[model samples]
Target: MGCTDSKDNLTPEELAIMNGELSLMYQAYQASDVDLVYRKYSNDGIININQWQNVSSKLKLAAYSAPMPPKIQKFYDSLKAENKYKLRDLLVIGIYLSTGKSIDKARLLFEAYDENDAKVLSKGDIQQMTSFIVEVAVEKTCVLIQDDDPNNVQPEEMAKFLQKLRTVKNKGKQELCKMFLGGNPALTELTMEKFVENVTMPSTVQLLTFQGVRKFIKKQEVTASKFAALTSLKKPTGPSDPKAELPKAK
Candidate 1:
């Protein structure tokens, strides 16, 4: 005889109760009421609550599955092999800043000195990077809110989020530094690769594959070159050339 399935052995009444409990648990999850959800399910019972928890977590990930913009995708495609690590760091920094998370703690990931004795990104450097991220986020958010359909994000909601973002930005670099660094000053410094491993979230890491850091670097380079070219152009300090006189002075 074939082995019997335990689920098949449940009586009609038992099956009905199990289904009802599941339904109630799902409702609680949708409402984000963890206490109610746990009350309806037994963690130490035969119901396999861990499986249901995993399903709920996956559903939450689905909401942030918005695709990156085409421009960002192209930038990511253009990055050289060596710059991949930099791109990863950029993504982590972007995610933290966008989520209003602290970066001071992340600074512990940098080394005090490289092989050449040059220092890596200091706390001040991190603060500057955060400011740059906040500016870029503000610009992107502004464009997103102007769209007829901004990836299912409502205009009012986006406006409110932006307000919160600006509030964080206005806290100034020192406050931002303190928030991330905390009271502890002693922490082991890791390389960029190690740092990426610690900070990259599996569910959201794909969002950064669009070359966010590369795009920012490219934009800065273009702006700098344009400024240099404009500065190099010498303005005329004398009157118009005689050869180009205006119609014999009319």
Candidate 2:
């Protein structure tokens, strides 16, 4: 409800943030937009055992097993061992997993921002959630590159960049979470005017373009041998260029 607040008085920058067009924004910020099956499940805080079971089942079955966040794993283990818990707990667990935070951290966050006894997940939760996701993203990128080839320059460069980014504190993370919360409907006791006021400052927005993804790999980081190998692969050239082709009819 808060996310769709009237845009009549908002500035262009704020509008763009809420419109979900920011370059560096994470897909996780728009989790509900990409046809996730669990998006329909409501997070109201009424204690309901059946609802918790349903939510947990859906989350577990949604994808093939992979390493889950610690909190999520713990939540599942506890649920399996003893099927007694509050739906509120499960809702917080959902946010915890989605935002990539440990259960302890997420629980502490819930205590601070839970609008109504864990009934509502407020906008305050998005900041750390996004920060952790971004931190993890940078770390994962470095790890994957290092695993593939320890000598790769990209990973070293990326690690250095990540460290540099960290030096600025959580400024980037805060901006990202601002955009995330502004775009998402996870707010309580927060005013659109207040959000617009804070987000109006264009200087704070951080775009994680990473050479717009394509150039980051192909042009900037790809080894000559790898580039050559990629170029050598058979691929569709699409329709012939009309100007390069012989005149159809002489």
Candidate 3:
């Protein structure tokens, strides 16, 4: 009970590195990159973390539980303050594992790690969440375009609409135009699977059209951004689109 903290041994270098401001320290812990992880902490031949609980007891539990690289403790610690729920369950054990004790313990911890509901989270969690959102957005766009009507417009025009939809800055405006002009056929042609393969799910995908579609892109520019006059626009699907009906007399 006198002084049993494991982290108490702060080598001079560890104090200097109190972080080089590189999240790499965190990654090193994850990769088990001893060199980099060594840069961030000191082991004073004993654990003496000055925190919510006793350092030795903390390491013992972490050595037996927790998931993710032990260094993520920093991120989790920050999250604990705000998203107490997100880290409460994971960090209690994660706090222990981040110490770089033993992978065997990590594996065991993972097995029983679901001890609590996924704890809440913190602003720090946004980094990973942002990446995931981008992926989802890209995929959603692709699926929305599949099943082109094939008529009432050509595949060429359909494709142009998609290009603009992505390039445009505002989602609300893009939605308005698409609704007013009816569905863009090119988009209907792009399937969810194809979209995911060709574009970043959550990112901007540059859509290029053949010469004909390029013509459409320009035409839209000239039409004061409104749908072209009925007389100026040609049949929707060119000679394709099996389901498209014929144009009636003026």
Candidate 4:
């Protein structure tokens, strides 16, 4: 079948058939894959009122779904009627419920968006959001593995251990040190791959997909590089007299 730029020419029957196609395009667009929409139709004019209604219905269903955590359920119930359906508000709460993130943290993530405006994210915004999620995941995994609290170490001690891990050049050595610090026999055999899996498949989330796994790995590499630079800066020089070396040059 041929594609058209305008939906005004299509009859109701045609619109019904096209609804499925439009729905998929809309979903992809919502997911930050606008390239797919452009490749297919090159414009948003084809979407009809029904598609908008469908999206709203789906969002409502997702937002009001049962078996939510008590905290989330209470928060949702507490929203004023007008605020309940607000896109940014629902989305902030939705992310908190879906990712097991604190509601305040999720709200902070969405703070860039206006409270009354529709929550439309640009490509750059999506990239920033993804980076934030990956950073959070990496930090959470490192903290879990370190288990610094049980050892009677202060929070600063745990931070130091993580700093030390970042400086370690060998991935294997990092994992070994993390395990030793954690003092968990069960995690003694845990590898980097296992840590990645654990972060991607937390108890509250089913699966984060290969993209999440890849991002986790890439984030770790960047973090290590950053810390390596800092570590190099703090390296001790040999016990040579700086004055002797400077005077010899003169």
Candidate 5:
């Protein structure tokens, strides 16, 4: 469980690459420049984490959905903890422009950080991001899944779903990802309505402890026997498939 070193402890070579370089990282991600972001973070092996780990495929999707170097760099401190705890301040900056649901969750999560204020996630944020992310994943996975059996994902669960998709071999996971995306807990009827019908609401509920979901996914297929064993009880479906898989490990 020991970590290597904090970003502060990085050598001059590393520091030159990462210090106060968030905007550069964001630009790299926006342009979908994998190599640039990779060079930036390949310097740091830190795996950004969150509750979405319960489903492996979901997490993988988020990482590859775009170059998330800024998100990775910002969440560096919090996601590095040996235990499961969220870094609210870190999430706000990266997720604000992420998507609407993500923005909403980020707002609520940020509010929780500022518990005295009782702030919440915004409606407009969720709708926009959902539309953008889903449109992308559906387009990518639909073509890939049929031809090469790639990850078919819906936007709502994209973040949570991809976070966990990185654990094992991407091959087997591809075969089972449809079930994963299909089994997605789904945005609530009310939440889905907002993005679908463009209804408006003031704020939405954001679960605090629920952020640990990704941690749960890493353990889903502890072993092949257990993987099959667990299913004996209720005929478990394979792990959830994120819309896409991460190029990096979570």
Candidate 6:
């Protein structure tokens, strides 16, 4: 009838064995031996299997978005006109142009449902997704200039903001400053129109914008998991495999 501490449940020998086993398991997990981690932990209620699967999937998708090699680019350019226009095909091409990565790689960045699945991506999906990303991106830049204020950023404030971004190359930073501030001695303020007009590299802007948007999306209570699920497209079979190519133009 005596109470015993949890540690007291195990003998010294049993505790030593458990400690040693846990150490090895920790090492394996740290090393990212996913297979081993899953094999050992899957049955234990301690593992969040869905989360682990998602993390693994995202990592794989990240690899796909990496820059495409020259060979892949050349092959992509040679695809027939018809093959070039399919939704998935166009997405690959768009990603290639945007990120300089092969479609196979870029495909991982979006949702990966079966092409045959009736859940075709709508124009609304594309528009909403792109708008969400760009808005988030622009909002982030706004935050850098003025913390959470909805008012337009002043010229001097914009200049100081750009100056502080010294980590960016001098040429690029100056260009960005000029773009945002314009070249007029009398210029007093930076407007949203000027901001949009001066964005020299829309692609770069979009990419940077996507990064911020992704974080924001992930933080939203309701949309967080939904966004992740949306981006989870069916995995591309292979970059160069013809069999994996999007259906030829109708």
User: What overall lDDT goes with each candidate model?
Assistant: 0.35, 0.38, 0.29, 0.34, 0.30, 0.32
lDDT of residue 6 for candidate 1: 57
Question: What tens-digit string does per-residue lDDT give for candidate 1 at 1-250?
Answer: 0111255553332233223223212222322233223224423321232433443354332212246344333333332243332322323322332222222223322321122234444455445544544454343324422233314555566556445445444443333333333322242333454343433444223212112322333344455568889999999876678676557764
**Can you give the lDDT of residue 103 in candidate 4?**
28
Candidate 4 least-lDDT 10 residues? 204-213
Residue-level lDDT tens digits of model 5 in 1-250: 0112464553332222222222222322221222223223321323244332321132233333344444433433333467433333223323322223433443333332332342322333333333322222222222212211123334434433343333432322332222212223242222232332221122212111111121222334356447767777875365466535545765
In candidate 2, what are the lDDT values of residues 34-133, reduced to their tens digit? 1133334544433344554454455443212354434334424453325444333333333322323222323333343444554444465555445544
User: Which rank order by TM-score, best down to worst?
Assistant: 2, 1, 4, 6, 5, 3
lDDT over C-alpha atoms for residue 87 of model 2: 38
Question: Could you estimate the TM-score for every candidate?
Answer: 0.28, 0.30, 0.19, 0.24, 0.20, 0.22
Q: Which prediction has the highest lDDT against the true structure?
A: 2
Distance from true position, residue 18, model 3, in Å? 16
Angstrom error at residue 183, model 2: 12
Off by over 4 Å in 3: 1-78, 81-109, 116-236, 241-250
Alpha-carbon error at 182 in model 2, in Å? 5.5
lDDT of 2: 0.38
- What's the CA RMSD of model 1 in angstroms? 20.0
Angstrom error at residue 110, model 5:
13
Off by over 4 Å in 5: 1-93, 96-188, 192-214, 223-227, 230-250
* Colliding residue pairs in candidate 6: 64-105, 110-231, 111-231, 111-232, 111-233, 112-232, 112-233, 112-234, 113-234
How close is each model in CA RMSD to the real structure?
A: 20.0, 19.4, 21.8, 20.6, 21.8, 29.6
Model 2, which residues run further than 4 Å from truth? 1-123, 149-154, 178-188, 191-250
lDDT of 6 by residue, 61-125 (tens): 22123373343333333432433222332232222223222222223223311233333333333
Span of ten consecutive residues with least summed lDDT in model 3: 203-212
* Better-scoring candidate (TM-score), 1 or 2: 2
Candidate with better TM-score, 1 vs 3: 1
lDDT for model 4? 0.34
